[model samples]
Target chain A: MTSLTQQLVDALGIMVLGMGLVFLFLGILILGVELVARCLSRANEASTPSMSEQPMPALDSRLVAAISSAVHQYRASA
Target chain B: MDGLMAFWAETGIAHFTPGQMLMMAVGGLLLYLAIVRGFEPLLLLPIGFGAVLANIPHAGFTEEGGMLYYAYHVGIETGVFPLLIFMGVGALTDFGALIANPKTLLLGAAAQFGIFATLIGAIALNLVPGFEFSMKDAAAIAIIGGADGPTAIFLASKLAPELLGAIAVAAYSYMALVPIIQPPIMRLLTTQAEREIKMEQLREVSKKEKVIFPLMVLGLTILFLPAATPLVGMFCLGNLMRESGVVDRLSKTAQNELINIVTIFLGLAVGSKLSAAQFLRQETLGILLLGAVAFGIGTATGVLMAKLMCKLSGGKVNPLIGAAGVSAVPMAARVVNKVGLEANQHNYLLMHAMGPNVAGVLGSAVAAGILLAVLG
Candidate 1:
């Protein structure tokens, strides 16, 4: 059986590996968000007529969250 | 008359002994600093009270059967309070800013370079007289660089509770000093224009993103560092409770009432460790001196990394926000914002800085976990 020290060493190695993974995940997440933003802006450019008139109100989050939770509860009831 | 004189000499004038009197007085000084000057009042209040309690000559308060000793045993020795504090922090934090600007994580990661560097410095200091430090002790000591109280307390309590007195004081003192220590380093590292650089407005962070973010973070922590799970998991739970839209009452209590209660007990218990025999030593002085060095190096490294990021991104990042990468949370971020306004009134860096500010908390907790894994 592995001694506690060996187990601890193994854990240390895993944690280091995990930190690297966190960095990678964060990097990928940033890139993905930026790319989606580009696609979204492009879609807006193609669909809209005026170059700049009045921007649409950004997605209202609190409303959506409330609606979603209410629907979820309703579904549960049903 | 001789008997009365002897009793008075033993019990009245000579009762305290010099060391006991000095430590007891130090406790009162701490209280004055906390209440009047407002130096980390949440922590300093309890710590001061505990210090007074501990140093009352032959109090037996922090002895084996003492109340403070029992409190320490139940909460700190078991490493429960810091974990709970982490949970409250997680519940209170709004992670949408981090998710909106994930690039800020780099600044957060860059700041932790201080803790590791200070670890080496601490080991070197072990060569000094009155300082007998092991690798575990050095790691615990260096976590003051993280500018994180719970992480410092968590690591010190586990790796070197003997050093808990110095470490806790160092951690909170530096945390309170963030407004003082960070600005000069920030100004030194960044040009006036770089300090004034205004970040583009952050995109609206969707609530869905906010809710899922904690879960994703918790998943990562569990997979990567189980030792950090207590700190990280509790933090995630707190954030989840806040974001879930389902448990506002529990979330509110956790953030306000629970955290306040824990802070009082935690501060007192930590203070109780600061007896004259433990705290008023040459080694404690060394810990205090090295703590400043660690915080300075950490801040400088973070600023340097932000400078690098600015160069890479063609001056998109305000290097001043790099100073916020230490885990003093909104305090560090507010200083960045205040400095930004001084440089240019139109510049608003608070929201942007908060992304890295909160991320620093996670990064430090992770770094603390790494230390625990190695040392514990």
Candidate 2:
């Protein structure tokens, strides 16, 4: 027969093992949520008509110039 | 003339034992390591000084209730110094990265594999001649792998006080040697491609989340593992002191002056335990050997766990950060960043690794408590 000390040791081992497995599971679970969120957002964008069909909203004049400059640089790089 | 000679003979001390003389030399070596190598001088200097004092021919400082004995009773025996140290650690630690990237908690959990594996190995070592250890002793010895000094002391104090000197010395020594002990294992475990993997930027964690995190951990620890209450309680108190921003003076004291002062006492107390009788035993050598092996395995396990996550996440995670999981704090995290940079200049893993770095401290404390509750 196993001593009480042995039994307690066995029980402690199992509990610690359980805790480790839980953390591993939780990491994967969080990653899954991020992946799902990214996928759903992409799908929503595909279903909608392009926003360019509507007139662009008015922006601060400085902001508009800055946006155009950034676009121009990006296009040159591409 | 005869009376003067008699007085000199009576007042003088005896010649040193071979053991005491050798320990003095060892003490000098530790002093050199601290001063020259810049390895944990805050603790090692005091510990080395204490060893010198204790091993003197007739100091009797380590006698029943001397100052060194009292220091042991007040600081280490009752487990106050370690808790106070934890408080300082909490203040020094920024939980922002950990709270932002909670998934890194797994790396911390995975790192503890070394502790339990060492326990098994230690128990098995008892089968050899000249070494005999109980479960409590094995557990205490195994905690050296956790790489956190206070957690090792807290557990050893409760589980096996006699071995506290050897265990605490081993723990602190290994902690200082982390940059040396860890890198080779890390290199061996990862391929050039894996080492060169560049991870994307981590998301920004809000200040509010960082402020609330210690409170949450403190609450969970109190409810679930009351045995861990002292460690969790003191650490949370330090974190609260730091974040509350109302008591900057006390926070600074805990983080700087108080912890530094207590580190001297803690180190000296630990060093006093290195008498030839206690520390020079065959079991001490076995503990050191097993501790190193356990550390290697823990590092490997943490890396493997990160590789698995990399696979699951389609290689977005950097496996190098996994080495920071063993609770040497920012040092381990900094090493991760340094190694990552060596592989690729642009790859910085510092902030990313801190998530698991701080988490590993908590993981080791919890593991220590579990061992105490079960093994003690």
Residue pairs with clashing backbones, model 1: B87-B234, B90-B239, B91-B238, B91-B239
lDDT of 2 by residue, B75-159 (tens): 8889999999999998888877776677787888788888888887776676577777777888888888888989998999988
Taken over the whole model, the C-alpha lDDT of each candidate is 0.82, 0.79
Candidate 2, CAPRI quality class derived from DockQ: incorrect
DockQ of each: 0.08, 0.08
Top candidate when judged by lDDT against the true structure? 1
TM-score for chain B of each model, two decimals: 0.96, 0.96
Off by over 4 Å in 2: A1-78, B1-13
Provide the lDDT at B20 for model 2.
85
- Angstrom error of the Cα, residue A5, model 2: value is 13
